[model samples]
Target chain A: MLLALLRRFGQMIFVMFGISVLVFLIFFVTPGADPAARIAGRNASPETLEAVRKSFGFDQPVWVQYLTMMKKLFVTQDLTSFVNRGWKVVPAVLDTIPVTLSLVIGAAILWVVFGMLVGLIAAATRGSWIDKLLMALGLVGCAMPVYWLGEMMNLVSQSRYHDTWLFSWVPPLGYKNLSDDPRGWFLTLVIPWFTLAILYIGLYGRVLRANLIEAMQEDYIRTARAKGLSETRILLRHALRTSLISFVTLFGLDFGALVGGAALLTEVVFGLQGVGKLTYDALQNLDLPVIMTTVIYASFFVVLANALVDVVYILIDPRVRSA
Target chain B: MLEVRDLRISFRTEHGRVQAIDGVSFDVGESEILGVVGESGSGKTISLLAVMGLINDPNARIEGSIKLRGRELVGLEPREMRKLRGREIAMIFQDPMTAMTPVYTIGWQIAEQIMAHEKIGKAAALARAVDLLAEVNIPNPREAIHRFPHQLSGGMRQRAVIAMALSCNPALLIADEPTTALDVTVQAQILDLIRKLRRDHKSAVVFITHDMGVIAEMADRVMVMYSGRIVERGTKAEILLEPRHPYTRALLDSIPPLEGEKPKRLRSIPGSPPSLFDLPKGCSFAPRCPSRFERCAERPALEGGKHAAACFLKVAS
Candidate 1:
């Protein structure tokens, strides 16, 4: 186990290095790209541009510039954003990490719980009307776009029926710090959570339902039933146990992507200043330092998520250990 | 003891209704082994699945009587049937490699069965599981209990499955091709284990397989099934030594003798069994029977006797 963890850690470092090189080349080494001029801002004096270029080492060789940028980002930790003068890229990302983690983690929990519940119910009642109805509802949720869904949710709770009893307790757009006020944080993020989770709940529910149905047909499931275990016991303890492997794999990818700024649409619609929103603003302003850091940060989550998934995969399936 | 009378099973598919098992009846006496021999598609596995109340297909229809100790089990609800499973009746399946859940330890699975009906403490159940492993002659029972299904060899897995089936001392044990997937040597060993388990537990056993050699070696009585119907049944010696029904004779002829003049070619019954769908109007085996005559065009009744054969020729005599 320790060896596997160490190997995964090495892989994570390699992947981060590769992504950083790619981002650096695109911003600094690409033809016609001028970080010096961009940092100096539009219609700057030649003296100001030269000063910025020299100070930031943009006038140095490509490798030297890359090394200097790495030192600023990692060692000195003062890689300021070109668009926002006072904003340090690393600290900017760190500050928004909690907001993104809250949104993604809450939505992940909601989706997993509801998805498994819906999937289990659908599988149990497979050919009945209950199965059909649940699956159809899941399909509808999966088909709806995240941005559209978030807007619709806001329209209903924040404007259309803000004074009504149904949405009276709804909070305005924006995120709250959980450490400052736990209840307020929860209430504030609840709608965004549902909006973000709705699509996944459907997609995961359908996938889980299919997986469970297939697992139920396995020879071991018949053995479970022959053992006199109740259908519930057989379904949960035997069928679902094996079925969760695929679910976990899918979750790792989805969770990592969301934390890496795939939740930008939801954050923009809900007015939450998450890493996704931060990345969106950086992209709009062509902020190279901020974009480079966010890209590397996102790759870290993706790589880490995959490593965690592998560990979980071995935990649930013994056959993999021997293999 | 177990008694099945006029038991029929039909399945509805997109094409039409298929009569999978047609009016089959048999009894398993206490401490006796009844070997059910049949070729594939003869409902060998389906019949036992029905008996175990494990057939949950929505399109399947089951009728007639299944009585365990004179209590009707044919119409029993799934909830009530669950109470009898593992304790009153236990089943071992065909593929030992896939028989047990792969995630759990073999010992945990056995303990699950023991606790399913016994209300025993976890420690006692686990101790009993270890004892069962030892009873099945597994080496290092203590270590084997913690191993997963894939870690064990094929023969060991079969033994573990058998150990689990006998954990609760069930009165009726149904083994469906329990050794079919094993090597010839492993097959012999599994058959011997079943025989020993029968003697030890005093449980009536229904051994289902297509290997006639296994039937002869393991069964006290044998029943031959063709196209989901019983074609012949008698004492093992009576059937093996002097078979009556042409199908049974054909089945016996197909067995290559260990010591004898080697035939130019091994005997095999010509043609496959009739499909459950689009079955012939008369005898289902008439198309494939070498001795088929004019009377064979009509259905033959399964007559009652110490040795019964479902053939018009036998009835005429």
Candidate 2:
């Protein structure tokens, strides 16, 4: 077990390194907008541009700049944003991290539990009216875009019924720090959480329902039932564990992708300043340093999520460990 | 000991109600190996499943009495039936590859059965699992316990399944073509294992297969089924040497000789078993039975001493 963990840790480091390099090359080496111009803004004079270029080491060789950036981001931890005019990006990221984390984490919990419940019910009653209805709901959830759904929700709750009991308690159009006011934080994110969760709940519940139904047909499940296991035990203990293999695979990749700023649409529509929003703004302003940092940050989550999935795979499946 | 009498099962399909098992009856005596030989869709597997109360199709209607040690099994609640399955009766399926859950280790899978029926802790159950694996002659039981079903070879997997079925020392073991998926050598090994298990545990076994050689090798008595009904049933010697039913004779004659001068023309059953939906009005197998008579338009009843056959010829004799 110790050896396996150590091996996984080593793989994680290698993946992180690869991702960091890719992010650096894509943002820095790729021919596109000038980092100097982006940092200096449109109105900077020649002297200011030269000063800004030299100060951030843009005048240095590409390899040297890459190494310097890596050192500042990892070794020294003194990275600052050229686009933000010398402001430290880490503290800014730290400020928004908790809110995004809360949103994703809460949505994930709701999606998994409620999705599985719906899926189990649908599968158990396979050909019944309830199954058909749940499946129809799943299709709607999968077909509707998250951004569109968020917009629709905002219009209905914020615009159409702002004075009504249903819409009166919606967040006041901004994120609140949990430390400053936990209630405000919850109220602010609750709508966004539900909005984000809607699409996933549908997709995941259908996938889970199909997988569980398939698992129930497996000979092992029949054996389990034959062994006198109750329907509940057979469903949860025997069938669910096996079906979760695919679910976990999808979850791992998705969690990483979401953390990597794939949730930008939802963040933008809801006015949440998540890493996704930060990355989008950085890209728009051609801010290389901020963009690179966000890329690295998102890459870290992706790589870390994959590593966690590997560990989870070994735990859930003995075949993997044995091999 | 288990007794099945006049068991009939039908399924509601798009065409109409298809009779899958028609008036099938057989008794598995204590410590006797009863071989059920038939091709696919012969209702052999479905018969055992009905006995276990695992049939879940909403359209399926089952009528019969399955008595195990005097208790009627047909009308019992699912919960009660479940309790009876692994405790008093157990089953090992045909495809060993899919017979056990893929995610859990063989030890965990076996231990699950033990824990389900008995109030045993993990440690004790695991220890018992290793012991059972060793009894089944798996090499390095300790190491093999942690390995998943996929890691094992076909033969090893079948052994693991058998070990699991025998975990609770069930009175009856229903092996639904257990060795069908295995190669010849593995098939022989598995058959040997089942024979040894029967002797060691003194458990009655209902071994389902299409191989006459397998039936000759393991069965004390044999039942030959075609189109969801028993065509012939007798002692292994009687069925192999003197098959009363033409379908049984055709099946025995169809086996290719392993080492001898080959026949110029291997005998083959003339036609396929009739589709369950459009079954012949009278005899189900009349189309395939070479000795079918004019009176075969009426269904024949099972007759003849302890060894019975559902045939007009046998009934007339």
Candidate 3:
């Protein structure tokens, strides 16, 4: 197990390196955005541009710049943003990461627990009116875009009736650090978390319901029932564990994608300054350092999420251990 | 001892109500092996399932009294029935490969059964599991316990399943074609293991199989089922040698002896068993019975002594 983890860690480093190089090439080597011109603004003279280029080491070989960037990012840990006038980028990332992390983590907990309960209820009452109603609600949740939903929620709770009983005490729509005030942080992000979780709650509930129904049909489940295990035990212990395998895999992939700026719509609608919003802003400003930093950050999360999923596979399924 | 009396099971299919098992009755005496012989869809599995009160499909309905040591099992609540299933009466399935959960190790799976009914610690359960594995003749039980179901061979998996069925020392063990998916040699070993375990545990067994050779070898009593009902039943020798019902006779003749030179044309039962949905009005086997007559328009009830057959022609003969 230790050897496998070490191998995976080594693979993670190589992947992160490849991702960093890709980000560098896309930002620097690409034709559309000129880092030299952007850093020296339109008012600067040709002499100032030459000096800026030389100081930033843009005059060096491309390979040398790449090596220097890697050394600064990994070894020296002094990654200065050219667009931000040589201000360090890592601190800015650290400031925003907790907000995003809390949002994702809270939303994950909400969706998983709520989805499982809804799924179990739906499956238990399959073909009943309750099952149909829950499934229809799930369909609506799946179809509605998160941004539209978030905006609608804000319009009602924040804009339309802030003092009304229904809207009273609603979160003010900004993220606060959990370390600063846990209660304030939770209250502030609660709506965003729910809004972000709605779609996944529906998707995961449906996936879980379908998988649970299928898992119950397995011969082993029948054997469990035959063994005189209580209905609750049979469903929870045998059926639920098998169904969770697919759910876990989906969660891993979806979490990684979300961390990679897929939740940009939610972040934008909620006015939260997460990686998604940061990446969007960097894209708009053509900020290479910020964009590259976000890319590397998101790639690390995606790869790390995949590694976590691989570890979970061993716990969820014995067959996967040898594989 | 277990007794299934006047058991009836039906399913509402698209076509109509399909009577899966119609008025089937049998008994498993103490330490006796009652072999239920039937082709697929002949209600052999359903009969045992009905007795266990495991039929939960909405379309299916069951009626009858399944008395285990004089306790009625049919109308008991699921919780009460479940308490009896693995503890008092255990069942092994046909496909050993799929019978065990894939996510857990063999030891954990068996230990789960032990812990389900007994108040035992994990360490003690593990020890009991290893002992059960060794009892089932799995080589290197200590090493094998840590291995998952897929790691074991087909025969080994079946042994593991048998070990689990016997873990609680159930009074009745229902093995539904336990060796159907195994090779001939492996099949023999499993049969031997089951017989040995039955002797060791002193538990009555209900063995379901279509193989006459297996039934002949392992069964003390035989119940020959056709068209969702027992056509003939008797001691193993009576059913094999003097099969009163034509269906039973046909089944016995169908088995080709291993020592003899192969017959150019082996005996095959004429016509298929009637579909449950479109069963004929009187005797279900009349269409396929060579000696069928007008009197067969009335269904024959089980008759004779300990060895009985539901046949109008046999009764007259």
True contacts kept of each: 0.78, 0.87, 0.84
Ranking by DockQ: 1, 3, 2
- TM-score against truth, every candidate: 0.97, 0.87, 0.90
Worst ten in a row by lDDT for model 3 chain A? A81-90
Clashing pairs for predicted structure model 1, backbone only: none
Tens digits of per-residue lDDT, candidate 3, B1-317, equal 79889999999988888889999988899999999998888999989988777789999988887899999888897778878888999999999999998888889888888888899999899999899999999999998888889898999999999888888999999999999899999999998998898889999999999999999899999999988998899999999999899899998889887887998888998889898878888888999988899988888888987999999876577
Which residue runs does candidate 3 get wrong by more than 4 Å? A17-72, A75-84, A164-171, B118-131, B139-147, B289-301, B315-317
Q: Rate the local accuracy (lDDT) of all candidates.
A: 0.91, 0.86, 0.88
Candidate 1 structure quality by residue, lDDT tens digits, A258-284: 999999999999999989999888988
Model 2: per-residue Cα lDDT over B85-139, one tens digit each = 8878999998998888887789998998899889999999999999999999899
- On lDDT, the stronger of 1 and 2 is 1
**Candidate 3 residue lDDT tens string, A1-323:** 89988988888788888988888887788887567888788888999989988999999988899888777776787888776776787778777788788888889999989899889999888899999999999889889999999999899889899789887878787887888888889877888899999999999999999999999899999898877777777788888887898898899888987877788898899888998998888788777767778888888888889889888888988788778
Comparing only chain B with the true structure, the TM-scores of all models are: 0.98, 0.97, 0.97
Model 1: docking quality category: high
**Stretch of 10 with least lDDT, candidate 2 chain A:** A82-91
lDDT (Cα, 0-100) at A19 in candidate 3 = 87
